[model samples]
Target chain A: MHWEIVVGLEVHTQLSTRSKIFSGSSTVFGAAPNTQASAVDIALPGVLPVLNRSAVERAVQLGLAIGGNISRRSVFARKNYFYPDLPKGYQISQMDHPVVEGGSLTIQVGPDEKTVRITRAHLEEDAGKSMHGDFHGMTGIDLNRAGTPLLEIVSEPDLRGAAEAVAYAKTLHGLVVWLGICDGNMQEGSFRCDANVSVRPLGSGVLGTRCEIKNLNSFRFLERAIEYEARRQIEINEEGGTIRQETRLYDPDRDETRTMRSKEDAYDYRYFHDPDLSPLVISEDWIARTRAAMPELPGAMRERLVAQYAISAYDAAALTASRATAAYFEQLVAASSGEAKLSANWMMGDLFAALNRYELDMAHCPVSAAQLGRLIVRIVDGTLSGKLAKEVFEALWQAAGEVDAIIEARGLKQVSDSGAIAAIVDQILAANPAQVADYRAGKEKMLGYLVGQAMKAMKGRANPQQLNEILLQKLN
Target chain B: MSLTLLDVKRVARLAHIAVSEDEAAIYQQQINGVFDLIAQMQAVDTTGVVPMAHAQDLNQRLRDDIVTEPDLHEKFQSIAPQVAEGLYLVPQVIE
Candidate 1:
């Protein structure tokens, strides 16, 4: 029987706040093991947690960006659990009422767009880290990440495949980063996903047992984990065995999932409203102010770029994939007098390659938008050939010099003068008599060869279009 | 509400508890008590009412993408049980 894979993701994004959610401890990662732990973070006796207003505001901004229902009143609850990493013995999370509800994110997977419905995004405190291999025979706890605010975004089981799941996760990552709510860095554990995967026979009405895969910090791992777990469950069911609903951990090196523990139902947590803090009350004015402060989200910006700039959907999506990339493209376009397509190409192709090679963010990009704009202007004005522009771009990227200065220093100007190009074409035709004869005999393929020789003879400075026309004229 | 023998073992295994045959009868009674309370949740008309995962409509807060400090070598290693040079010491299994 054909099997259908059902996937839902629970993404935990660490909020980009200066301090911990309920304490004033610095939310910086890689700090000393216990230095950043505040009184409330360690659950010191009689210490109270004061919710950071900035964290709340960040959450409100995210709700507005995602078109979620902003709750008028929400309550934090103590999720009772026993773990060494949890300093409070119970994690303070939303139980009965969460902060955000009923939002949807649209992600493009392959050639189709899929909308994954978000069940809720709730505010919760992160647990401390337990380093198991740090000691000879024991583990050590690092409280640096403890008490860090996390927004757990839960999605409905609308995803049907691994590609859709990855697309959904990536889209969420981009949205969080664009809203300035999270850093969306998977390596630093700023953004993590727990995927719930199950397999049911096609046309089956009832859902199958699911195993929740945890600690998938990368998009590749999320897709792989879901694919592996879904196949495993289907195999088990086909072999006349029942699927065990449990929590599993993905081992990236081995590329398989092992059972971590049995999944806990809601009643197992014994969730109750946290008594120390009052019910969170967000006002209309607060929502309005946050909404007013919202920047253009990815979807809106993508539409605007496509409509206003007449760029392709792929280019627009690539430009708007990240906030910094979008900002760089917009700045390049603005500086180049609204040459949007050229700006998009440079940013997506050349600029992106350099950034990836250097492992640098767009904010710290070595090539400034102004320098890139000048190079584009030179290309548009025929001062520099397309080939010469690439050379200029590299020089300016390496030394942070002006585009015009680089162009002048290298003497890499487009040979657009008809007389100069015509002379080069004449020399090429004289050297390649047989090719010229073939071209005149209607062997159209020979034109490309002559054009290549002409370009090479001109030292790659001649514009291909002008060289092609001049070469064809001389050939005919 | 009563739990069959199979339900008792499933719940025990799901919770990662070791339940023996003698204790299975007692757990069966205890789980039935818990299930009786949960059965009340089914009585409420939830056909249209959305199941709530959190209390408020808040998203995750993010941090600035700035490197605040260099890698701390000795300070982070100080809390480890064993350390050699800059690496944490672990028992050698193969050797």
Candidate 2:
């Protein structure tokens, strides 16, 4: 019997506000243990939480970006639980009304495109860190992260498998970063995801009990954890056992999901609307103002790129994966006045490969976009063949001077002059009489070998197209 | 609804408070008395009335996102029962 895996993700994105959501304390990471924890963050007796305006605006930006309905009035609720890291003993979150609700994100996995419906994106505060092992049988609590603003984006159970979940996650990550609402840094815990996974018989309309896997900080971990959790559920069902709705943690070291808590000891977070904070009311003017300040969204930009540059949707998607990559491509095209196809090919092919090899993102790329544009221009003007262009690109990657200077310095210019290419082609034809006879005798593949010889004799500087044309003429 | 002895004991456990059998019995009656007041309130037919989250029907005041707090860990940790290397110490709570 085939089982289908169902996944829904709850993404917690730390908003890039300068202060905590409700307290005026520094939200910067890597601070001394509790130095950034203000009186309100530490839950002093008299301190009260004042909502941050920037945090609200950022949430509104997300709502507008996803085309979600922004709640005109939202309320904060307290989730009561007992945890050492929670100084207030209760986390103030949204119970029913959230700032942003009902958004959908389109994700592309392999060749299939699917839209994952977003349930809600709520504004909440983050808990502090608890260091367990090094404190002599006691835990050390650092409240620096406490009260930091987080927008928990919940998705409906629309994803069917691990790949789709990852694609959805990546797409959401890209969107948040593009919107400038969140830094989208997973390493420092700026962006985190909790996946709710369940498995049921294929084609079943009813849902199965799900086990939520928490704190999957990376896309790889999200995929693996879901795969593991779904398999575990299916195995239990097949063996005449029951799947428990519980919370689990993924141990990447062991590559397994272990039960963190079950129904037996599950936390009953008695939720109530927080009385200390009144309802947050957003006006239409504020939404309009935020929308006016919004940048061109990636989807709209991608459509424009497709129409203006006449590139494939796949190429456009790859270019607009991040705002930086798209900006770099545009600058490259402007600098060189090169065809969009040529620029896209070079960027998607060589530039991306080099960036990956160096473990660098576009921001850290050593080669400037203009330099790359100049190199592409060289290829267009017949100064550099594709092979020789790669050689010059390497030099440029090393921060060797301008593209033209590097070509001149290394004597890497293509032998594109017709007379020069013809001479080289003639030399190759004379030296390879047997192969030339083979080509004339209608073994047409011999032309490739002749072309190779001509390129090699020219030290790989011969213009491949010109050499091929001249070589074919001589052979016939 | 009235509170039972078991309900009193469970609520005590959730709140991390210790209660004996006699205390649970007394607490159950007292909690049930409170629930009776809630039952009386629920008896009122206030259909179509909007639910109120707070006493005052007002919007939450917004604050500018500024880092106004300075380093006060030294002053704050001074009052904590246990501290080590600028961190508050507590019995290990395993997840």
lDDT of 1 by residue, A1-476 (tens): 89999899999999998888887678877765667765677675798776777777887887777779989878889997756667687899997688888789999978777778888889999998766663656556666787899999999998987888998988889899999889887899999999999888888877788889988999999989998898888889889999888988999999999888775542367688777777787889989988988888899999998999999999999998788888889889988888988898888888899889999988898888888998899989999877788899889879847988887778888778999989878888889889888888899999888888888888899888888877766666
Candidate 1 residues B25-88, lDDT tens each? Answer: 9888888888888899878888878644345444323333322333344565566566543433
Q: In candidate 2, what are the lDDT values of residues A1-476, reduced to their tens digit?
A: 99999999999999999999998899999988999999999998988899999999999999988889999999999999889999899999997999999999988878877878999999999999999868889999999999999999999999999999999999999999999999999999999999999999999999899999999999999999999888889999999999988999999999999999997888878889998899999999999999999888998999999999899999999999888999998998887795799999999999999999989999899989899999988988889888889999999899889999999989999887989988878887778889988888899999889888888888888878888888877777
Candidate 1 segments whose C-alpha is farther than 4 A from its true place: A134-136, A263-267, A431-435, A438-445, B1-95
Candidate 1 overall lDDT versus native? 0.82
- Estimate TM-scores for all models: 0.82, 0.97
Say which candidate scores most in DockQ: 2
* DockQ values, each candidate: 0.08, 0.89
lDDT for model 2 comes to 0.92
Q: Number of clashing pairs, model 1? A: 19
Write down the worst ten-residue block by lDDT for model 1 chain A: A261-270
At residue B4, what lDDT does model 1 achieve? 97
> Interface RMSD (C-alpha) of each candidate?
9.0, 0.7
